[model samples]
Target: MMVVSTMTSPDTVLDFAHAVALGLSDRPRWLPSRFLYDERGSELFEQICELPEYYLTRAEAAILRRVAPVLRRKTGPVTLVELGSGSSVKTDLLLAAYAEEGASVRYVPVDVSASILRTAAERIEETFPSVNVSGLHGEFEQALPLLEDYGPVMLLFLGSSIGNFNQAESLAFWRRVAAALPRGGWVLLGVDLAKPAAVLEAAYNDAAGVTAAFTRNLFARMNRELGAGLDLAAIGHEARWNPEWQRIEIGARFHRRQTLHVEPLGRRFTIEPGELVMTEISRKYSLPNLTEYLRCFGLATAHTATDDQRRFAVLLLQKGE
Candidate 1:
């Protein structure tokens, strides 16, 4: 198992502190969702994936299972680079398909969490001895520029993670990705299609409460890492669909007035009752619009696959000359 450390622990901590301080000071208090994926948060998210109401994982996996072989044939021999690859459970389908085709592939799983990235790299190496695994430990932005050194590669941005970015951010992000990729490189993007508000709401607010636990884990992370004395019990999980934005906003709603003190920043933030501090946003998209959007970034759609119900889609895109 090979893991490359692109970011040092002190650098990561500083980045986190800056993001937290800036976000908390915003007019509408917010937190960078990326920080929610510490070791514990990652585990909670895996549990949330199994909830029946959370259909995203099942839908994307089904599509990948069906299309992986086709993708292998189309892309020829190329390394698989997955952004924000957590556990990489769904990625096994793609790796297995390549193996069956008698193709020796290299996989690069990039993530912010070191522990999860290391574990995933070891597991993949053990399970698929023929495939080489190189784990990159850092944010997507940090790893994107390094893709040029990897030669021919297929960038996998699965699980609708792009939804975390708003329009401007997404456009900027894809532009950077397109600039980073070698000509003719590929990107397999997973997106959740726009759906009814009720369905979107239920997906995030699962009956099993796993999703809630996963969101609430952010507080635990803040308290432990940032030295922020956050009262986890004082905030409740909230998920609501914003039709105007075509996104589901997940936030922590304070039950009562509370003050949080961060030892690292030596700062204090106060929250009033019912105040919602946005943690994440899952933006749904229309397939047609998304296809056009990618074109602006020099990414042309090569193939598209979706679940039977059209709840989710995994598009195979190529960076053009």
Candidate 2:
């Protein structure tokens, strides 16, 4: 069974305009990282994961492969609910593990992109004919609440996506997730660990320039969706590692001062020369910090697996029994 719920409410558009107006009005100018996943942006991100310098995807995949057997045992016969389940390429291992263990597995994948969600759902059903796949098309927060009705679900928030949120946001998100799960429910969280600054920076600003393309694609998205006139050539990608924040920051910097107009918002803005519009931040964390963060939300780490490089970690967290 395949199910998808798009934001039929007009509020989705209003929310976009409100966020854009608010963010662009702020000093330093910014856009939420969530806006970076339109169809083209999603495709670019898939390419980015394959880049030699982008180790996060591969490292997380390695950890998932190693831990899938354990996850199969822990999760038993339950639905696997995944948030931001893009491509879902790495998830093949987990699904395979459940099937091999003779678990009656049902898969629910949630994502904002209908095309991506549908494509992934089709692939999952076709490849693993025995497993049932249900695709939910919506934001994670909205989709999470629906999980409460399911039985013994295991949530998959992979790709270090939690790193997109700050400390407070992360806590609030996990609290909501914890509240949505039944007892013995699990959350498989993929997190990028704090490593050498050079390594982290390289992951975002890859030598192959795919990451750069991905960054610039945001402007293209704005132009396409918001009817914004943006000179793509004038916008360049810049990624820097902030030691104080312990995160890698990526932004679109203007080459020259210019005025931009968005038809949807009916607003115009000016960009100063060399000014940056912050696009995304990938926060790295330590095990102790993450453990405490999860603990605050009533989640305890049941098991953790890391790649041989130890550059990434996947934690199997469960609400207190």
Candidate 3:
């Protein structure tokens, strides 16, 4: 089900290719979080949204619904552009605000999964025929330039996908996003606030084993795409919260010793009897920390709101006009 090819793009420069080759040159053989949403991964994540312990989606949606009116007022004509825009269901809540404002609206959803993008865009067209839905099939870091064509865009980096990047990576990403959008362009982001250790763990390590399956699917993807002999049963899902880092790390742990030979870039890594193949990290943030972080990158805070009891926040940050 996975297709393999050598496609070049802004993000796939030689360095990027070399980095990816070296990064995946590990025993368990890993796939990046961005690849986590390949059709199956996307569906699994959708299921994650409803899990009782996964309070993030519900909480962030609550905040957005409450603040989007005010957010729309400032970022009017709120040309909605969401990065990693899988399905675009949650986004409808905010898009409705733009529609209600009688503002001419355009919705651009960017993602790497062509299947997911095609299906999402089609469904969106059905629900809101007047809404212009464009699909960009690319990763966020590389896809920012594609956004130029749609600028004056109020970008959406929703659903705590921000967690996947580290602080330095985040700053670089924000800088790029800010540069793509001129002054007055808005970025509405959903961030998982720092919370108790147990709560964070439970959400990712769900009872139904959905998250686990989601993690293991990476191996399935690698084996299918890169000719890597990675056995899903040999790996287990691990999610842990790091307070100091204010983030959650998700990885696939190899239980029994097994070496995987990845053929994509001709590399291999020894599989220790038990080792974790780090795949994703989701960072939590506080209001002050996030505000200062974005400000350091030249983006100014336009508005901020949170769910009752501060479970999570959806912030509207803008490039200074």
Best by TM-score: 1
Stretches of candidate 3 above 4 Å error? 1-20, 26-31, 101-103
TM-score, candidate 3, is 0.91
- Return the clash pairs for model 2, or none: none
True-structure RMSD for candidate 3: 3.9
lDDT of 2 by residue, 1-321 (tens): 655567444226556666777878999788888877777878888999999998989999988888898888776777888999999999999999987745557888888767777888888888887788888777888887888777888999999899888777777787788788877789999999999988888888888898889888878877776767888999989999888988888899999876776677789888988999999888999999889878877889999888998899999998888
Task: State every prediction's TM-score relative to the real structure.
Answer: 0.97, 0.95, 0.91
Task: Show where candidate 2 strays beyond 4 Å.
Answer: 7-13
> What overall lDDT goes with each candidate model?
0.88, 0.84, 0.77
Better of 1 and 3 by TM-score: 1
Question: What's model 3's overall lDDT?
Answer: 0.77
Q: Compared with the true structure, what per-residue lDDT tens digits does model 1 show for residues 1-321?
A: 455565545236667778888888997889889888988888888888888999999999999999998998899888899999999999999999887745687899989877788888888888888888888888888888889988899999999999999888887899889889999999999999999999999999999888788888888877877787777889899999999999999999999888876667788888899899899999999999999989988899999999999999999999996
Model 3 lDDT tens row, 262-283: 5656777667767888878888
TM-score order, best first, reads 1, 2, 3
Backbone clashes counted, model 2: 0
Candidate 2, TM-score vs. the true structure?
A: 0.95
Q: What does each candidate score in C-alpha RMSD?
A: 1.4, 1.6, 3.9
